[model samples]
Target: MSERRSISSGSVFEERIGYARAVVDGDRVHVSGTTGYDYATMSIADDVVAQCAQAIRNVEAALAEAGCTLADVVRVRYLLPDRADFEPCWPTLRAAFGEVRPAATMLVCGLAEPAMRFEIEVDARRR
Candidate 1:
């Protein structure tokens, strides 16, 4: 059997928070919960729709590094701070995953950061 490998993007959380940004085990990639905070500025956007887009962008970045793409995604988990934010952002989410049609779940919950409105995590398999 091939050895499993862990991958990270030098996110400080990998050290301080006891979790990797992404883990690659053979042909599978498991991405951790990612928020809309721009890594460059370390700031979360104020708008929920924009935040949803940014979160998906972050997921794509991790998937790319794992040799996968949105089309390769098999599952998605969305954590929303408020249920009210879901409808407004559904269109964006639907458009992004329309082709992939990955299994998904969205839940209402508080996030790790106060300013963050949404957190997205994904699982992808290489073709």
Candidate 2:
């Protein structure tokens, strides 16, 4: 049987909210919806594009901890509060995922905080 383990990004939310940043079970990794906040400083950008880039980096960190990378991602979810903000983030998003080309979904909804403009979550299988 494959062991299951949780990964953390050293974010207070993971501890305060009681959830891991990602979980690795068997050959699969499930990463939680991660926001744009820089875990080191808990800082977020005002521009959605910048936020999108940071969010992707945060997701990358979690995936790396699980012995995976964006190339291993089979699914991805993008969450945004404003639909318009998503377009401006396309360039940054494309730069990160253009090659990986994982199945993706984008949803317009309220996030945990008003300052959070973008969040991302992913599922990956080790190759």
Candidate 3:
């Protein structure tokens, strides 16, 4: 049997909300929906595209901590408060997953905060 590990990005919400950024069990990693907030500054961009970029970076960091990368992602989920925002993020999202082309889904829905225009979640298998 393999061990389980939890990775944290030091986001206050992780503690306040009672969740880790990602959890690793054996060869798989499950990363929670990450927002655009730069954990270092605790600030998020107003532009949806910019937010999408940062959100990808955030997810990458969590993946890295688990010895994985975007290339190892097996699944990805993009959540947006406005469906219109999804198209604008495609380029950035494609830049990260174009070759890897993980299974993906984008949903139109509300987020934790009104300022949060985009959120992303990923599942990865160690490769």
Candidate 4:
């Protein structure tokens, strides 16, 4: 059997909701749906583009803790309440995943917090 390890970003939500920011099991790393809030400040930006960029940074942090980077990501999922926000965020997302071109999906759905304009989740394989 393979070993499993959990990583945390020290988000209060993780403690209340009982979840890790990411988990590493064998060669695979699964990052939880991460919102745009700067975990250190527990504050989020109002602009969707800014939120998108912050969300990627948050995901990258988790990926790094899992011994991988965005380039190792094989899948990505984006969640937003408003579909129109997706296009506005494309450039930021492209900048991160453009080279990797990981299998991707975007969903229009409500998030836990109304302030959360964007959320990102990813899966990566450790090289």
> How do the predictions measure up, each by TM-score?
0.92, 0.97, 0.98, 0.98
Clashing pairs in 3: none
Which order, best to worst by TM-score?
3, 4, 2, 1
Query: Lowest summed lDDT over 10 consecutive residues: which window, candidate 3?
Result: 85-94
Where does the lowest 10-residue lDDT sum fall in candidate 1?
2-11
CA-lDDT, candidates in order: 0.86, 0.93, 0.95, 0.95
Output the better candidate (2/3) by lDDT. Answer: 3
- Give the Cα error of residue 54 in candidate 3, in Å: 0.5
Candidate 4 ranges beyond 4 A from true positions: none
User: How many collisions between residues are there in candidate 4?
Assistant: 0
Count of clashing pairs, candidate 3: 0
Output candidate 4 Cα RMSD: 0.6
Residue by residue across 15-88, what tens digits does model 4's lDDT show? 99999999999999999999999999999999999999999999999999888999999999999999999999
Going through the candidates in the order shown, the clash numbers are 0, 0, 0, 0
Error of 3 at 52 (Å): 0.5
- Put down candidate 1 lDDT per residue, 53-122, tens digits, no spaces: 9888888888888888899999999998899998899898988898889999998999987888988899
Ranking by lDDT: 3, 4, 2, 1
**Residue 63 in candidate 3, Cα distance off native in Å:** 0.6
